[model samples]
Target: MVKPKDPSENPTTTTNNNKMFIGIVWNCVPELKLLLSALLFFCSLITLFQFFPSHLSFSIQDLRQCSPFPPPSSPPPLQIQHPQLQTDNNNNNNIIQQNGVIKRNFNTYGSAAYNFILMSAYRGGLNTFAVIGLSSKPLHVFGKPTYLCEWVPDSTGNGSGSVTVSGTKILPDWGYGRVYTVVVINCTFPSPVGIDGSHGGRLVLHASTSGGGDANFNLTDTIDVLEEKNGLLNSASNELAEFNKPPKYDYLYCGSPLYGNLSPQRVREWIAYHVKMFGERSHFVIYDAGGVHSEVMEVLRPWVERGYVTVQDIREQERFDGYYHNQFLVVNDCLHRYRFMTKWMFFFDVDEFIFVPKKSTIKSVMDSLEEFTQFTIEQRTISNKLCYLDDHPGKIYRKWGIEKLVYRDMMKGIRRDRKYAIQPRNVFATGVHMSENTIGKTTHKTEGKIMYYHYHGTISERREPCRQFVNTTEMKVGGKPYVVDTTMREAAGAVKRFELRMIGSALLKTRQ
Candidate 1:
């Protein structure tokens, strides 16, 4: 440290210091001092590079790898063309994607409400349409929206001239909420319209919802491939033909299936009581709507085997109109089923038993009416003078007289205000309670001796139509306590006898 710099070896440092001192002396002169300072700064920079060349020199690859930002890129191409599709002619229904759209193939599918779709299938002939409702937003928002359709089997099949697509906009039916904007797509399948198995294929539907989006909606779930109504009805007609074959009976009681909390005990009692009371003159046609127990069916097996009762399985066909209206359809179907077979058809529920005082049996009442002048019989349709035979206001068996547990505690029954028996062929259509139109113009109120002994107290516990009736019905004489109609002596007697048979060892053994 003491031997610092040798005067002889450090001559350069001394020279540089002398030069800076000379420049400072000249700084009194403005331009000359500025120029000398610039020269000195440039020399300093050169000296720095000479000492640290490693820090300054770098390659392009090294700079790129060390950089924090990403490299630039170009956008992907637009996808307009659909992919290859695979079709099957034998398959009932198949789903696939083709030409950037989803394709569906089906043999049979019918009109059904879509849970997510507001529009009705709106199918006619070979063409299927989406009847848009209130909730559908504008298709234009997704670019140029169009419903593209094509024929089945042939992958390249375009729509035939008969099959055309329309962008027609219309309002939906009422009850679908207020209309804002709606559009319908006329989705047309291949040729051979109105035939179920003609094409055995379905029209593929694909629609663009956005400017650059793929076909977003597949309408196969919404569209219904329609077939000839008669073709659809053929099997049912055949079944009806067998069911309605003319029987040697004067009266027939028709009703929908026995469902709900109706136990075997009650069903047995009802059937036995009717069979005993009506003798061999009456027959029953019970439609099994749903939920009928095997035990109940077993009890009626013997009677059914004897041809005295017929149980048509209503579940065999699809119920399109829901419970009540389907019930109406079934009841109407019954009228047509036995139109020519039974002279007097009685439409009543199983809980109801028609009571006749003077004429004990239905056959007696019908026979008595034969010579009467109220209605005259004619070929095809009946003479237009007479109407249906109405019962006098009837009483409901409000409570069980014996206090038996079999007669469950209910509000009891009430008077059946209005219900009547009609000639099936004479009536054009039948509803839940009354006929829509009869061959005759006037409906004459018959003598009041006949009454309906309704044991409908336990109706609240039953399923569907029975419960629906009680729930919706505004009773005329409600809030009254249970009152047994003492005049129903025959029904009272039948109850006891049936209870004995039900609890007795004999019927129980037969059940086993």
Candidate 2:
């Protein structure tokens, strides 16, 4: 009555159970499963359509953030550099390689125990050797007999079995002008030999080359692990470098007072090469020696015609005659102001260049070392006592100094006829001391390359009669040739002896 009782009733419930059971037939259960799966699939598709684009946008943004684009560097931005840290990249504080034995004013550096290593090597039948310098500068072997190493083909394999060369044997001194060859003899300590001695480790070596002036002549050294010895080839971490010279330069500025026998083509080539070494964009104030410079100018006329060189004449001004050497420095400083961000000023003479252990340069050497390195390297050449191998005209005849001493009492005596200007068959023994005005006095820079080296020839070749007795013959200073174990001691002894004579003279005068 109450019509059909509520389905919640027991009979209705039974009917519902029967319907559920019946629904199992006709593939209804399978059909429901299929429907559920379809629904899930459709939902997934919709979610993908809604979220995929958002994910794609995020991915794009992430890619833009991490791309390999160079970021904006710090303010007084770092200078772009070359691989060698050679002076070619002059504007970049990055590359300052030492090519010759010209002492530089390094107002930085300190004395640290250096680990020197000497060995020889070969690559593809190219004769090569390795010499590790513990400190900077490798131009000491000059004007003297030096102990060096010979090359052995099977050198690397015969190395006393070692992986890390950091804690290797005490480095051998292979007097200057040599690198990367086997030590002719191995010893833990330096041998007291002839005038030239290897006190500090001179890892001298010889390498086989196709010809005489191949840059393949190089040194192989290991740096302290703590000093980032991971073979960094950047300007700061520069490794092996190829010397590539461009046909021309950005600009060329000649200097003054070069009045000497500097080769025209050679000087031009050096300017072009070094300008590129310091990093491609620069001008140099070259000091040309009158007639010699005119010839060079004619050769360079083509570049000038093309406006490649902004020939700024720093000459013809009121010259500072008293301190002409300092004037060179003035020209160097002026170069910086002429161009902003110019990182270097090469204030070398026509015949001079800064040297380093192997291929290292001033910029490269300083860049890699700690800022507080407080040792000074005074490059004293044995080339000439008063003569410069790369002598320009400005270097006055040194005979006057010797004559002043000789003629002090013998000006009018018969001794005058003995020799109007006595040319000594052999110069008297003398001590070699660097001028206090030289690099050792006023600078604190990280250890640098040897200041200069006279590779073309020896100082003996360059000396004139006026230079009767210059330093020594082997031209590479700051090297083994001039690295005298007894130099400092000998200098002190000489000073003491001079003082005694002076006091005795004073006492005799007073008694009279």
Candidate 3:
């Protein structure tokens, strides 16, 4: 049988025949031409579909993956909703169509539409400006989002403020599982500024991602606009004021806010240890975050009276939840409190110590940074090196020495130090282990030059069941082998002396 002729065998003939047939069809009746055109369009669509698949299903998994917080155990995950699409005045169509079905525009700005987590707000130096923190990035209509903040004066008869819609700027926060966009809004009022310089009032945030559409999203609760009281608010003013004037103290170590009913003895030890180490070169700002023993207060009073320490009650400050969260607040307050007076400040906890291996003092170690001509060092962090102390329950009064220091048996993982020193007026917000934001400057992470030792098992009363240990790794300070032991011993000595004097005074009072 004769083999069937294949079209692929004659490339030139086949192309000519196909073109002639298409030309005939093009000149044929209009209905046939239309039918041919429709078939071609369908074929083209199939080819396109092979290359690009349509994304119809919506899932918040994309946003959740970028969240800084871990996935919650209980509450169900954010349900995927088909977002409404609407066209705006701007030539760009904002319609989000899925599978040939067009849904109505869904405005996220509606108070009931989307969840808004207002973290914090700080009014700018100027009467017209304010910076606010949003829990997550606002959903906008293809263009840059605009934020409008409405300031309503306190019932104390402070007048209302006007809202001039200004452009919005977003800062992605991957650390908190939410994008905390810092929005700057311009607010004006006919009368004098109603927001108190000390006591701030509430404001509503009107956020819109659409092009001049109705701003339906509003964050109402806890929309506090903190007054710009710190001189650091204006960077230029800070630079000018601090240039010639000498600071009163070289550095200030603001101790951690005490809470959770920590052992008074341990607290006393922590305070005294910092005092003995950094007191000469640095002033201390210590705060009682409530639940402090009277005995501990008595031990700290002498230092306070001498002006070496500034004692503050946590109750004096605004209230907040979470242990470390409140601690950050106290640190921020201390930064503002001593911004201009001191050249530098270290936000430190009692359990952690910045161990200067070669230098005697933290200030001296900081001074060494001048040698690094590459960058102007504004802040420095001693790498967190966990050094667990062997449980010595019997030797409560006995001194902490090299033998008691278990350098070999240390925590296995790397502990990044949260404690840091900064030029007081330069940093904006500080976190537990580091500053969230600072002026345009560099940080000197002294991983090798300095060591940060965190003594976790200090309180003899509290014990961990599975205390892991690493090999003996000695951390020497000032060329001394027993540096931690000596410093801890001094802390113990301070506690012991205070206890003895308290007893003696009681006896003397009874005799009298």
Candidate 4:
């Protein structure tokens, strides 16, 4: 009844109510927006914690343990520790210890028995391809292995391509009855594959028997394709045009694996004398087969610092039961490793010394025989025990082995194994004595051209080598004839002066 009497008054009251409600909402606008924003931020934080809890609560170690992917399977990169004798202190003892443990573990379980050592790929020619590796002798007992070349994309936006080719296992007959051998997997591509260094590809070698089902024996890690100078090609011309030209190096020495208790003084003398003989444009690649101890490293550190030597820690090679400190394997690896870098590569032992007669220099001898791809130097065996009867014992004992021990072993008609040098680019697989597989000719008639003095059993002898003194006229000792050969002794003074000039007085220090 009241609504019926005041219709107009009701309208005015409704209008006032509407105005008050709108004013209240306008006054509380900022607070409502703040509340909404706070709720949204809370929800966002909850979502972030749910999805990525490790961001706030995990450490690097924890994250590593929580990773879903498996660890890498490839063997750790070979550690080439340059001899930094100056900065090596007691603090490095801990580092050395760690390295010893690592080497032990690597030898124990780095690669399988069938896996390859020092694996690399190369383009032999436009149609011919090769992947060189050092593996067990039984690798080809079943049959030849299969090779797969996976090529990367070119600059023209072409996709990566792959080709599977049948391989021929070319094993050099120089394993010396050892377990490991050099396996050159020769693959003949139907068409020239784009797996050259210009395209940057990888190689996968599969170990398949005649019976098959041996895919698991495949090399787990892929070997990168290596070209001459790592594909330094002429952009204006075809890649094949520059492929034949190998990088130049005057001289390169691939030393045998150093093992056992090596004499520091002997090593020092060998390195110094060779450095003098090889001249400035020479490099020495030495492998440490558990023999490059701290004392030996100290002797070699200066030469390493001067960039004349490279010491590779191949102590892991001992883990494998290979031939004679893996000499064949190492030399083959070194051959392919430095194939492009060096023009002529020498294969010899530290106990031996390469000598050219005074009338002709090493350059002239090598130049004269440049037409031949490989040449074997005659081994003039030197006595390790015989000494001059007239020389003073104390003075002679202090001299270098080559200088003090001047007696040459006259073992006539004895066919001693010869050390040889090669044009590495032309050589496929090398050995301690020579390479059986080469693209060019090999000559063993290097009598007057070049020769080496083999001081057998002298490198490891720590004590004085003057076991017996013989008169200059005396010709025989212990059923073997000996003669005083002063060729190396006459040059000792010059070598000593050279060592002093290059390494200062450090070489004069007595070995502990």
lDDT of 3 by residue, 1-512 (tens): 99987767888888999999999877786988788787666555443443333362133445344444444455555787755655674434345576756544443433322323343454332344334343233333223455555655555543445333442443322233222222223344332343343333455566654432344433333344443332332334322334347888877877667644454445554555566556555688877766444655665666676577777776532232223434544565565556667876776566565556543556667776533311221222221232344555555224332123334222334444445667755655555556646665555556665555555535323322123322334554434342223433334555456545533333111100
Question: Residues 1-512, candidate 2, lDDT per residue (tens digit)?
Answer: 37766666878789989887887765477888898787666555444443355557665455435544433344653685544533432333343345633433323244221113221221100111123222221222211112234321122232222121111122122222122211221212122211111111122242222222223333333222111122222233222222122314332333434544444433433343334334335455544323234555653454445343344433432232212322322232233223222322233444332334546654565454323212233333322232322244454332111111110111122211000000011111100111111111223332344333322222112233233323333333233233212222222333334424423232111100
- Please list the residue runs of candidate 1 whose C-alpha ends up more than 4 Å from where it truly belongs after superposition: 1-247, 318-321, 358-417, 441-447, 457-482, 494-512
lDDT score for residue 335 of model 4: 76
lDDT per prediction? 0.46, 0.31, 0.48, 0.72
lDDT at 237, model 2? 21
lDDT of 4: 0.72
RMSD of each: 17.2, 29.9, 21.8, 24.4
Point out where model 2 deviates above 4 Å.
1-257, 265-269, 287-292, 299-310, 318-322, 325-336, 359-363, 369-450, 454-512
TM-score of 3: 0.48
Give the Å shift of residue 489 in candidate 3.
4.3
Best by lDDT: 4
What lDDT does model 2 reach?
A: 0.31
Clashes of each: 6, 79, 14, 0
Using all chains and alpha carbons, the TM-scores for the candidates as numbered come to: 0.43, 0.26, 0.48, 0.70
